[model samples]
Target chain A: MGIKRDISHTVWSVRGNAVMDVVTRSLEPLIAALRAAGYTVVGPTVKDRAIRLTEISSAAELPDGTGDVQEPGNYRLTERDDGMVFGYAASPDSAKRFTQPPRQTLIRSRGQVIEEVEPEAPRIALLGLRACDLAAIAVQDRVFLGGRHPDPAYRRRREALFLIAVNCAVPGGTCFCVSMGTGPKATAGFDLALTELAAPHRFLIETGSERGARIVAAIPHQAATGDDVAAADEVSRTAAGRMGRTVDTEGVQEWLPAAHDHPRWDDVASRCLACTNCTMACPTCFCSTVEDVTDLSGDVAERSERWDSCFTLDFSEVGGSPVRGSQRGRYRQWLTHKFATWYDQFGTSGCVGCGRCITWCPTGIDVTEELSAIRYGTEGPSCIR
Target chain B: MDARQTGRRPRLAVWKFASCDGCQLTLLDCEDELLSIAAEMEIAYFLEASSAPGPGPYDLSLVEGSITTPEDAERIRHVRRVSRRLVTIGACATAGGIQALRDFADVREFTSVVYARPEYIATLERSTPISANVPVDFELRGCPIDKRQLLEVITAFLADRRPVVPGHSVCVECKARGNVCVLVAHGTPCLGPVTQAGCGALCPAYNRGCYGCFGPAETTNSGALNAKLRALGMSDPDLVRVYRTFNATEEPFRRASEEAEGDA
Candidate 1:
């Protein structure tokens, strides 16, 4: 949708939100402003032939004409004729990498002297978080911050974040944010949000927080008319219709717990490599295990926490042997936990429906297909629940 | 712990059997930490480093290479008797190495083809891991073995604790390091799904599929991975060949390769 209506009435207020518009070329100034605001600006960039989140100093680094073709167990960077800045659906790794790092040192010891390492949280402005990513971050916040003893490192990183979200104009082949009610549009959990319109090559910006308002006031922008907002709405509306995959989340949060013996577990277990790809790629999978490492000399030692997956045999280790020893048990644990038990633990489903697990799986095992296999006796041809 | 607290360093001995001495060189490659490791333990009998031989009854023995000869088969039992704790290093010692390919074929046929005098050569029909001949405390899984993991195993044994070697797949390390899935993204037939994490997901980081140098992970569905590999244009022969590499004799790899060969 293009801004086709009359724009002589410069600022037609839409639902009491101060909306503005800026051409694509002005994103450089926004990047400069974020850098000037004492935040390390991280965004999606073309790295290692994929859309990877990395530190960027200029808006020129954004994947301008590059989009990604993502399918189950496959991802490829492609050239888009539309030249959309945020054309890609999701990155390989999400903002979770920035907030909850893969590994963190908890304590250090030399002989009898012990030292607890303080968490370091540098201010970061994440520039291109999608709606599903924001949902994933919210899920993580509940896990790491809403608990009795909040994770200090995760809390510090959470507080230090300045999120800039973007509405998805195009959905990838494995995306199911529409089914999860988490995407196609940025609803909340962002300082600022943008809907990139292609024809005129401009951004329809919506302020979500006071910090966003402050940044908007600092940057040069024109008032967005009702037509511009409608076009932006249309972009998300079209995206909502074009989801490549969908999970039947109807009673999944309740049903999956009982689906423990649903024969689908064995079917999936047969295909599941137990390689921990799904858990690792999942944005909201917050399980971790601590390891104590010592140097060649017996004097120095350190305890560090690294991301662990239920797919690992040691993850469920209790006494001498693993509780979930079989791939069948591990697979069941991971799927059931993500879809069902996560609500019991955190009052929210762990999956945000970004489909990273599907795209990153080496065997192209689609979660939607597995769920459908459980719900219906077959991988559904037309199931969108 | 007793060795250090009692004012005496534990004796560390390095032994070789049938294959290349690359695993031993990994110890010397630790130029920065070699001196520090030497300080912690007495380098009692490392033939590669020092010609000066120390007597048996060592505290820890780092054994490399596979048991391929009659003498090697007998020597391992003696080594096991002498050493308090025996740790096998590299694929050769832990899984019979590349030489274990002979386990699938006739060793006499190989000997007759290679050796000028086949009668003079005394060999075992199957090149097997040290564990097949004698007990092993820990087995460090890698082609040549990672030096850091080697050190960890050494120190952990000395300090009376379990080593921190994980049984998880290489995908864990690959994801932790933020390396994109080469198998998924590029349709490469990777053994990373079955291979254990040790080399820090080195192959995938460089945009290449893992050849399973560290052997099959604790949990692996190689049948499923082989199915995917087949979908990615890998032939049955290709599957057979890929699984028969560094960790060829690992049970899962051996079985999968045999299955692929059957299919071929």
Candidate 2:
């Protein structure tokens, strides 16, 4: 519904606004463009030793001159000498936090009369969001927007968003966007896409929407040469080369379920804390539960929807007992649904290969590693044990 | 009259045996929902709230803390007889509590270690759950039960339906809250995998590992967790000490602690 259908990655010239041609807008002006349009811009900010999406009014808030190092269960943000802006991988906070918050008040009731609670849909310009996260948001859209019962709340916040995608320049130690076919370069599903021309202190911006073009027109940007586009491609190519891990995308949907009986489940389960870190960190995991709270005077009662996890026993309680009574069973359900059954439900794979689960797991249980083990492990390992 | 026009509410009582009163405080902490609870049910015997005690035949009774003395043992039996529906709340009632550390060491030795007059004190050899002596209809996990969950438990009974407390690991809650794992990333030894879901994955969100306040989840893989802990440099003594914390005597942790110390 924004910037009327312009082709993906189409390079456009920023024309003069009401005044003269104000050629060449910098990173800070680009952020100002979003803020001027009554959009609250949010992007990766260095906070608490990690890059997280926080409210930003200018380019100074972005993790400039700082990059993060991530490995199996380890994440640390470090200072960079070259002062390169947008020189980092995905942060723990994503579009899901802003789109579907941890807690949402669903309904407030007083006996028979009940008032519905609508999600707060603020006009937000999301800057520096990565390619995998764009795909992850699409997956969320499928769950909340492309469903039979469209969640009004998710739909509201989602519609109010002005998505700005960033092509990956430096893949983290755990990133594998190449294998998932989700990133390293921006493909689709964004209003504006930016590629940081390596070490040049400049971003080659491409408009994917009319709103993006209008913003560019209102502000100022120099006409790009063919070398700028070529440089953008080269930058993305380098990022693709730097991927540390790879997801076996060769019919993962089929093999994951077919190998459901494989013993690797037990192998992973032993080291697996069943803490559900993977699901929580996942941009697409959308399970939630309803809580009914009555005020102290018993006059007003409220029903709130909170994020729920399949790993919890309370999630599958039936006839006074949880159906997934074991950690092994719960983990199997989570993985199988994410990798296998998700295709049947959403017409796509659930994982975008962002590597959050691996980086965040207390025991550092890697899903890709587990998948490989399941596909190639020896015979007869029971999850029940 | 549906108690709409009438002020009389359903009789409810809160009982404590041998705990820190953290669980009872959790109820008083429900400042917003307290009025709703008061409107629906009569506060028949919450010493934490009111001083006066009401007579028995209460509709519901919430018993906290573990049974520690002979008086506690007999008193709970009487409470069971009087209350129609009795639910045990928090670690102490559900599992034995931090005091259950006495389960590992000698109680007589403990008495001599602290008490001025060992002969004057009266105590049980083991700090046991309320269910050990009397029948408890439902058990809620957590050192101090989560308030919203407590509200759900009370309201569910009022509506005559089963409670919606899940028994999955703290991992799920961790994901729900979007907390990055402290254990995997920082090599912080955590019990989130085997610990039951609740507390909204609080510790992990704060960049710290879970201390297992809610006891073990439904099916705990202590063997695997132990192996990982060993790799992380936890000695035999560390393993024993880890399990012998808040819910020390809870079977899964107790058994794991016993196994860890059995060799050391």
The candidate 1 chain A region of ten consecutive residues with least summed lDDT is A1-10
What are the lDDT figures for the candidates, one per model? 0.86, 0.79
Where in model 1 is the C-alpha error above 4 Å?
A1-15, A18-24, A379-381
The candidate maximizing DockQ is 1
Please tell me the TM-score of chain A for candidate 2.
0.91
Is model 2 an incorrect, acceptable, medium or high docking prediction?
A: acceptable
In candidate 1, what are the lDDT values of residues A6-96, reduced to their tens digit?
2111122333654544323368878888888888999999988899889999988999999889898899989998979999888887987
Q: What tens digits encode model 2's per-residue C-alpha lDDT throughout A196-313? A: 7654567777776567767777666786666777777899998998887886758778888887677777777677666566777888899888877664445567888877778666
Model 1: pairs clashing at backbone N, Cα or C within 3 Å: A247-A385, A248-A385
Residue A75 miss distance in model 2 (angstroms): 2.0
- When candidate 2 is compared with the true two-chain complex, its DockQ is 0.45
Instruction: Give the CAPRI rating of model 1.
Output: high
Query: Model 1 has how many clashing residue pairs?
Result: 2
